[model samples]
Target: METITKIVTRFGGVSLLPVAVALLAFVLIGAPSSWVTLTIAGLAMGMMIFLMASGLSLVFGLMDVMNFGHSAFISFGAFIAASVLAGLSGWLGSDLIILNIAALFLAFAAAILFGMAAGWFFEAVIIKPVYKDHLRQILITMGALIVAEQMILALWGGAPMTVHRPQFLEGSFLIGDITIEVYRAFAFMLGLAVYVALYLTLNRTRIGLLIRAGVENREMVEALGFRIDRLFVGVFMLGSALAAMGGAIWAGYETLITPALGGEMMIVVFIVVIIGGLGSIEGTLLGAIMVGLMANYVGYLAPKLALTSNMILMMVILLWRPNGLKPAVK
Candidate 1:
């Protein structure tokens, strides 16, 4: 047990597993251009997943809340953002880059605001009552999810809605023999920016210190004159906002929106959270990238196994590191 603990500890110090996997895949594929394309696509997908999963990870890790209905926020965000974008179609279609950016920004902002409001209600009404009760949390959150989906159906109808990207974000640029979509590049950059901002906020700020301290020992933090509950509430709202932002971005990525969007994405989000280790942002990012790469690579190499690739990856990783690549609590 001591030896095993030491090994896990050693591995936890550095995040090299994902890099090793990428290198192995590159060698196995034996096609530089194809590998490069897959890698870029994988990275973009990973970033989107990271945006969605990061919030859940933080909430679960810090607040110990099992929010099964997180996808509801994602769906809501998508719909809200889509609506905003649709209303601003003129700006989005304009030839000016500034107008295009403004339209996209407005859509994202609306989605985030709505998500924050919904999160507040969710925490206040549904989640707060079931604190520390995993079974109840699951049941209640799942029930909320079903209701949320029904609400979406009523609002947006059962049909999938098409999402249109701004003119500037529509096409792809080629690098040698490789084609990279503009939106995907934008998504990757946006995700990276968010990750960097979050890392800084959590590691280099006082609020972050309080959040971590509160998570480790709420009583101690409370005694220090901070309102731990309020802090947690803020965290929940932030998580929901992030999920909504992800949903909006993903809606544009898919160029279609559906009520089932959130539910469909929940699987990937949970996989990322679990594999990355609950509450560990760095772990989540790495896990998301690995999953993204595996999906793209496997889809191209063996289409039949694409759906199960993430599962297989999860199983293998769990077998290797039961607590995940990096467990915040541990």
Candidate 2:
């Protein structure tokens, strides 16, 4: 097993799978315009998925917590962001770009703050007692997810809510025969920014070093006088915040959200996290891009295969590399 693991890890060291798949897709699709459009759309979609999945990966990889209720935060973020955007319709509706940007920022802020608070509360009230026990963590978190869905229904009712994008973000621009939506571009940039920020924080900062060390050996880190518990709590809060931010961005992309939004997206998020490697942000990005591209390409080429594409992808990848494309060393 160890030998196979080493070989797989070595083989997966360089991240070119997504690029390889994209090239193959371009050839198979055979339409430059259509391929370009689909590829951009896929990248945008994958970035959003990465945003949502990154948090879960971190928590799972670092804290070893099975948080089935993570989706609740996503739903909450979408609803809250939607409400904020609705209330700020005047600003969002304004033709002024600055106002539109402000409104969007405010909405995202509200969602992230709410997510942080909820995450802290969840960690303290529900997760603290179940440390190191996967079964209890799963059971309790799943129950939490159920209750959260109910709460969402109670608060927002059982109907789909529509979200309107800012005036500047509602349309598309054409580059030759290809069209790119403004909102999608924004999502891609945002996701990329988050990824860069996270990468730097994890790889270049002292806090990130502590977090990594803790992940590898919690006892060793704590023995060095750093309170690993507080660090972990902070991680949970950050993870929840990221999930909410992703939800907010995604809500704008979809233009419609329901109480079960998070529940529905959970599958994709988990798949991305799993395929990307449990705790690897880079892997998550690659996995997300691959899934996104696969979905768009398959959906365009064969609609029937779209729904099952991710599942098939996961199965194939797992068969090739059991620990995922880039599993955390710890």
Candidate 3:
């Protein structure tokens, strides 16, 4: 580890080795037969990862709490949207615009409230005492995840709820020889906007500046005028809200919400946070792209590889740069 760090420090991260290796990947295996489709799918997958990781990264950044329940929020969002659509479909003629608009707004409101509650409880109880202890946080959060999962099962009945694609987003568009789903395009656009908004919030606002400061030196900020404690709560709320938003968007894409999704998806999110570095937004983006692309591209070659690609990526990145893509700034 010391030797690798020394090498990176001396040679710098922009060395030719990475570029050469990247070129080699494309050379060894040229673009797939359906290169365009594959590329589009890969991009879409990566963007989804970015959305999920954004929330995870922010939570870890401020609270230092790895809320595995982030996935639960996603499940909740999907379920909420699915349920609303289901209700509307039964009475109304299943209009796409109305269903989508209704689902989106309901999901958004539900998610915000749910997320805020989660954040408040976490800070008021589990996290405040163990703020500085990694092991304790891990155990407590794991327990919380299990509890949340059970609650989901009890509430949603563990059924696989499917989301009906509205008429407007149900089909695809033909472009020359290829076709593209309208929903996928919408998802991409939404993800990009979320990313941009997060970046601006982190880099362009006073609250954001305080967040950066708090992350760097929580005690120091407390020593000053600001209420570092409330800041923690605010950060927690923000993170949870982001996760919930991702969940809601995911509901539209998958059209099915399952209780197990929280546990299942949380693992990937954990990897994203670790591989991308604890709190660096840039690292999270790059890491998500890497993980997302790996999953999509490898799935094309082998289903098994697709399932495990991100884990492998994590191992490789940790081996090469154990601190992750971008280590947290002090």
Candidate 4:
């Protein structure tokens, strides 16, 4: 085990896992253009998953809250963003880029705002009573998720909603034989920007310091007069907002969404969190990227195995490193 750890560390650790997977895929694919296209698609998909899962990771890792209802935010965010874009169809179809940008911004803003508010309420009302009790947390959160899905059904009906994209994000870019969707590129950039902001905030700021300290020793921090409960609520809210933003972007990616979107994505989000080491943001990103790449590559290579690829990956990873690739220091 020590020898394997040393080898991985020598080779730049698990961050290179994606690169290694990409290289293997390139060799198997044997076509430069196809490989490039697949790689980019995988990266973009990974970023979207990261956005959705990062919040769940933090909530569970730091707050010790098993929020099975997290995916409810994803569903709500997608629907809210889609509704906003639908209402602003004129702006989306306008020739003016400014209107297009405004419409897009409003849709995302609404989703984020709704997510934050909902998260705060959930934390305060549903979660507070279940603290430190894993079984109750799971049961209540799952019930909350079911209720959320029913709410979506009531609001949007049973039809699969079509999500319209702004003019700016409606096309694809071609480079030689490699083609990249503009929306995918936008998603990747947005996810990366969020990651940078999160990394800096968690590792470099005073609030981050307090959060980390609270995570390590909540009683000590509370004794030091730093309102840990309030900080936890903020963390929950941030996580929920991120999930909503991710859903909004994913809605555009899928172009069609249903009430089941959250349920479908919940499994993938949890897989990423568990295999990525619970509360570690970096680990979540790594797990998400690897899942993305593996899914795409497997779908192309062996369609029958694609559905189970992530589960297989998780099993193998656990067998190799049970603690996950980059677990946060407790």
TM-score of 1: 0.95
Instruction: Quote each prediction's TM-score.
Output: 0.95, 0.96, 0.86, 0.98
Q: Model 3, 74-166: lDDT tens per residue?
A: 666556656666665633245546765665566557766776687678667877887778888888877777887788788778678777655
Q: lDDT by residue for model 4 over 1-330, one digit each (tens)? A: 778779878999988999999999999999999899889889999999999999999888778999999999999999999999999999999999999999999999999999999999999999999999999999999999999999999999989999999999988999998899999899999999999999999999999888777666778988998888899999999999999999999999999999999999999999999889978889999999999889999999889999999999999888888978888853
Once fitted onto the true fold, the runs of candidate 3 whose alpha carbons sit more than 4 angstroms away are 1-33, 90-99
> If ranked by TM-score, best first, what sequence of candidates would result?
4, 2, 1, 3
Better of 1 and 3 by TM-score: 1
**Please, what is the whole-model Cα lDDT of each candidate in the order they appear?**
0.90, 0.92, 0.70, 0.94
What is the number of residue pairs that collide in model 3?
A: 2
In Å, residue 89's CA in model 1 sits off its true spot by 1.4
After superposition, candidate 1 runs with Cα above 4 Å error: 1-14
Score candidate 3 by lDDT: 0.70
Name the better of 1 and 2 by lDDT: 2
- For model 2 the TM-score comes to 0.96
- How many clashing residue pairs appear in each of the predictions shown? 0, 0, 2, 0
Task: Give the distance in Å from residue 213's predicted Cα in candidate 1 to where it truly belongs.
Answer: 2.4
